[model samples]
Target: MSGLNIISNTSLTMFILIGIPGLEDANFWIAFLLCFVYLMAILGNCTIVFIIKMESSLHEPMYFFLAMLAALDILLVNSVIPKMLGIFWFDAREISFNACLVQMFCIHSISAMESTILVAMAFDRYVAICNPLRHKSILTSSIVAKIGLVAVIRGAAIMAPLPCLIKRLPYCRATVLSHSYCLHQDVMNFSCADISVNIIYGLIIIISAMGLDSLLIFLSYFLILRAVLRLSWEVRLKAFSTCISHICVVLIFYIPFIGLAMVHRFGKRSSPIIAIVMANVYLLVPPVLNPMVYGIKTKQIRQSIMKAFHRNATRPELFH
Candidate 1:
């Protein structure tokens, strides 16, 4: 395959993706299942975003963060699943090198942005619960917008170098990616050039951006916990209840994320099944569960969703 000069010397063109196993030979059942999950994920995230937008009462900092998360989740899942589904349904899995780079950049950037937003959410909760007197002033609408802008800038700064790093590598072998989408590490591994610098830079970004963000989230929650301890029993319970949804979201995202990183770093490449499963988990699970966790755990969001649905169904003429 390398001997065939299919790709032009100057042009880094189409690359082959080794898609999920069993799909190539499986019947319609597999495709159906994936399609079902994809639809559910899109519908769930969209509904959450709509509920947040329509409900005037949810125009506060916490719900603002939740809406940001829902929007990110929609983008995050769309980045990978559409490509994967294309591979499964139509056997159209080939992605251009440039397309792959774009996908990688979007996925990594959005992931970083989501983590930063979570940190911002934690800070908002801390202020709301621990210092209610100053909550209104501290977490103003302008402040939340600033936090979102910072998240976008931070995400771009962290992931902007990744595509450049991948593109600079010498193409000794025909570019064959082993995943559905262009993951940064997966693409780097296929490079014929030495990847020591790329790996080091990647680690630095992860540790400094995501790792540091996680630490700050923990610290914020720790302070909130201390404050909760100082409060009366009823107040402590109320504060804890408000945070349960965020805590669930944090666990869902970080656990699979850390586990997948560990598996890819240490596990054997021969176990493609494990890699595929872990990749899907990291990409899909958080998006699917995020809206549900927030909707069910937070009374305000639940009521808002119900009210939105009722209004839409009952007052269709008003909406039109």
Candidate 2:
């Protein structure tokens, strides 16, 4: 049959996720390890949320943005890892077309939300550091709420159309995906139809989401540094101290993401597993690390965590 005929005639109802090719013997171990990572991410983020909510001291803009970031990290990881572990542990790889669409949308949109939240957090830090006295007046509760809402809405608005655009194409190629999740690029590779529009739109979204946010974040830090440099040595340390965790998170997010993009575009001859692992790391590491970084670096969070543990430890003895 001609390629054109196949493109015109073929239709698919589902796709099979081929999780980690050529490692069938180690699937169980991989799943076990991934489960641990997922658990850590969930517990850490949830603890951040709980402590922030319980402590009125954390009601400020910086902490509120941190809480939003933790929540976004949870959403981003949960969107992919549950299905991923299922594929590895049970060989449950089949995902219906609509389900795949929903998964793709959620994964990308949550990631976009994360990027925007990071930018928001960076702006918060800039305001706090560069204009300390005006920080409260600038990032009021209403403004913070609006930032969160815009992050979510921007992600949804940009990513919601991607799956639908891909859905309209004819997927005559192999239904097996490279990784354990429904990524936009991976799914697009299976379509036999003309995907120029889809590819262009995907590029546009990436630039608008990650590229733009990353640039703005860097700009915010640059301005913050200029302001911090003029302060006393002790004051400089105090100012930069508040920014360390956020800078760590930004590195954690962007480094792996940039590596993944490089691997995807230029590593065609490289091991497929390299691309897959990088992709997983890009999504998994930030969520898991953000809360830990915050909890350790931010004194209030550590004290709150200790207090929670002490209360829990004493409760059983009191009851007994």
Candidate 3:
């Protein structure tokens, strides 16, 4: 408890993070478990990126999009998990005002980029399964690079203003944060200045970015469904099989994200621990599960992973 250096008054330079609230008795175990999940997520996402990079057969637009998704997952996880562990393990919960805003930007911006990439992936799957003939020609290398660049720019462009907005606000009250990480919504709650602009802008950003992407993804799948229904039963199954991993990944990412958003928006009266846990799920589950889902459902990725391992195992110089 000695590390809980809470400051008061308008001159407060640090924001104290109460990790897992009522779970202080279990933060040791919690830190250990979260550390394990963080490792798994890092390892899984890294493996996905490495496999896609190495396997020449996977050099297509689909795998390229997947590699981008995996990379986003790695960045997203790395942006917060280490700071979270610091809170739990070392009582290093005191974050300077500027550092908190930076973390907030990283979390939201990376999330925006990830959402954009997922939409790109859905479009790729739609092209591959719904209109196979035009898939390769439509999704060229140059086009894919442009899409990746757009994702980066869009995320950075949209989230870049958040830190500035937070910076302009004066913190006249308690600056303690609820979650282990600094979220835009969470940090804005402590602002003593009028936050209506922040609230409205944040809502607009969510609606325009993630909300629009979700709708586009739904529209893509609907069209694909209609196209699939027109094909023969076996071909339809095969087409759907190609999309299964992506669908799982989308569901895992969006469901918890939606839940966390709902909790922040409507469940303010709910338990803080619930929001804490939901936030963790929103952040942690997708990275840890995405690669596993892809490895299981996509034969090329699975074989590539095994082949990667086997190739490493056969090297004799390592034994020396």
Candidate 4:
């Protein structure tokens, strides 16, 4: 019995995820704060999805992708934040090895999917603005669905190997993750086994997918700008008005993403904190800003939100 107990005690079980400093170390307050962020993110994204779904006028391809983006944001945040909050609230910061891998897979997968979806959205906008006559045929509902499916499959394919790589690693030290979540890079750093392959594959996947996506997005906008230049002043202004919000959103998403990558590659090991903060930004910032961006820029969504609120306010009492 004693030998069995020793074996059990020695077995690698839980990983300690060092959450954000300060409040995270204090107590449940940190958990509360994280929970609040989670709730806000969920609610915000859900509202976007609901508004897009219920409003027939938003049945266009762009709105369809926006809805998908919202749904992905909800999935991405829920997967990481709940587990992270649990780490803060409970003493049991130890997540199972498999669980850690799963978290990393889900987070990275959804992130990649979102990136791809943004690229698709950029392409959709380019087609709409540059070749207005061909918009309908170019962006049919069937084509949109196909693109969404391709995004999902590509995301899964890109991230699927990560968990397998992690599982194969032999952890020599106590598995204490340095961040609030099961980040793939953090997990890889803990491995006792050689991780040159893992590092290479991770960089390749991130650079090839995200890097290429951002490049395409920039090229799309460049073409869009050239097209805008050819138009009359009134048409150019209108086009810019429609596109400025999306451009802002793309910048918000990509700039920090590239910065984080560069920091990770060149900066000291202590830079994980920066990476963690940026990771949170990548996950949370887009969802919070998305509705606001679209709401201000999109006439239909704004009207729908107003109509929704007015209906709620004027509804008859349930008791009656």
lDDT of 2 by residue, 134-196 (tens): 999999999999999999999999998998888788766477888788889878877776889
Candidate 4 C-alpha lDDT tens digits along 206-291 = 78999899989989999999999999999998988877767877887787777666666666556566877876777667767776
Give candidates' CA RMSD values in order: 2.7, 1.8, 3.9, 4.0
Model 3 scores a C-alpha lDDT of 0.89
- Highest TM-score among the candidates is held by which one? 2
Provide the overall lDDT of each model, using Cα atoms, as 2-decimal numbers.
Answer: 0.85, 0.88, 0.89, 0.81
- Order of models, best TM-score first: 2, 3, 1, 4
Ranked by lDDT, the better of candidates 2 and 4 is 2
Q: Give candidate 1's error at residue 189 in angstroms.
A: 0.5
Query: Considering every candidate listed, which one attains the maximal lDDT?
Result: 3
Instruction: Give the Å error, residue 85, model 4.
Output: 1.7
Winner on lDDT between 1 and 4 is: 1
Candidates 3 and 4 compared by TM-score, better number: 3
- Which stretches of model 3 miss by more than 4 angstroms? 1-12, 317-320
Candidate 3 Cα deviation (angstroms), residue 43: 0.7
TM-score of each: 0.93, 0.95, 0.94, 0.91
20: Cα error in model 2, Å = 1.5
Candidate 4's TM-score: 0.91
Clashes of each: 0, 0, 0, 0
What are the per-residue Cα lDDT tens digits for candidate 1 across 1-320?
55544433246676787766765777245667777778878998998888888889999999999889989999988888888778777888799888898999999999999999999999999898888999989999999999999998999888999988888776644677778788898888766657998899888987998899899999999999998998899988998999999999999888888877877788864578888788888888898899889989999989988887787688868766
Sorted by lDDT (best first), the order is 3, 2, 1, 4
Clashes of 1: 0
